[model samples]
Target: MRQVLLINKDPDMHSDLNSLFQENNYESVILDEVETGNEALRKVVNDSYDMLILNLDLPNTNMLGLINKLRLLNQDLPILIYSLELEYIFIKRYLTSGVNGYCFFKNGDVGEILDAAVRISTGKWYISQEMVELIVEKALYSKKIDRFDNLDEQEFEILTHLIKGDTVANIAKIMGVHLPTVSVYKTRILDKLRITSLLELKNIIKIPLLSES
Candidate 1:
């Protein structure tokens, strides 16, 4: 039988997953339940588990750090991220961090959740359909931003200041340029970015900075 270490702070989630595993007739047992990342690390180090289902919101340790430590200890263990965070950036980061699968608790159905577990257990990656769509959308949005790469350094600087809620006059003062020069730069940036107004600029610029947070 395959053994799984389920790390989540919510007892109800643990119970639900246990029931789901049993109902699916998976010969897998949740061997341990841990509430925090530190406990998870200690358990995985001392005990044995074929798979790990991890919650991103662990209280006692950073999520990325815990995954890194677990990867160091057992490179072959299948790690599945069970998170409520719907941000594509977070999902992308976890996928890049050696996690074998991802399932959003709120958006994922039971079948997808089970499939994620089964697939990861067999050394395959699994991501929900919604997440795949989100990734694709982000990729397309990134391509749209690439069009503005032709902006000169000063124009790009001005764009950054504009995104940060800087007024045209304020940007001119900061860059030590006349207001008319800044206005011209702003017009050129808007044209290059293919945006018509400041609101559009704000919306377009948000995607590029999503991964930073």
Candidate 2:
């Protein structure tokens, strides 16, 4: 059985996660808080766990620094970050930080959390594809150039917006295209990528961009 450790400060979040993991037959160890980065590091060094679910905005300890320290200790252990902060730049930086996986607390679901855990337990990694689309699209817009050489201009735009957590209706308005058109673009993007879900998309983007943005 996979032994999973959840390091988060919120009670409701921990309860929800405990219920999910218990149903799935995984042993869930809950740490209500890490008083300091050193405390967290000690746990990591002492325990043998398959996955560590962390809140990036931990109190006092620099989040990225802690993650870096954890990486140094257990280079391949899974770190699943779920934060309430929803900034593209922050997420982008963390993705490039060599952590195992990530999800936003707002947009993330119980299924996503479980999915990431299961994947990581198998020595695999996860990233949200929408994240990839978001980063690449941001690059395209800011740089005023094509960041996705793999995609055509319109396809690139659609995929980028899609990954930004945009709904089809919103994407339609932004692209000046109909809802159906946006859906069609989504289908084509998925087909080209050979992926079926946004979860799969996350795994794809999270892994390749581990070292560099």
* lDDT at residue 160 of model 1 (Cα atoms): 57
Q: How much lDDT does each candidate structure score?
A: 0.73, 0.66
Winning model by TM-score: 1
lDDT of 2 by residue, 1-213 (tens): 256667766667777877777787665444334445677788888877667888765543345556778899998878888766555645665676777777766554767777876776677777665565776776665544322344555675566566667788877876677989988888887766667986676555533222222
Stretches of candidate 2 off by over 4 Å are 27-36, 139-213
Candidate 1 lDDT score relative to the true structure: 0.73
In model 1, the runs with Cα more than 4 Å from the true position are: 107-111, 144-213
Residue 191 accuracy (lDDT) in model 1: 85
- TM-scores for every predicted model: 0.65, 0.59
* Ten contiguous residues minimizing lDDT sum, candidate 2: 204-213
TM-score, candidate 1, is 0.65
In candidate 1, position 15 carries an lDDT of: 70
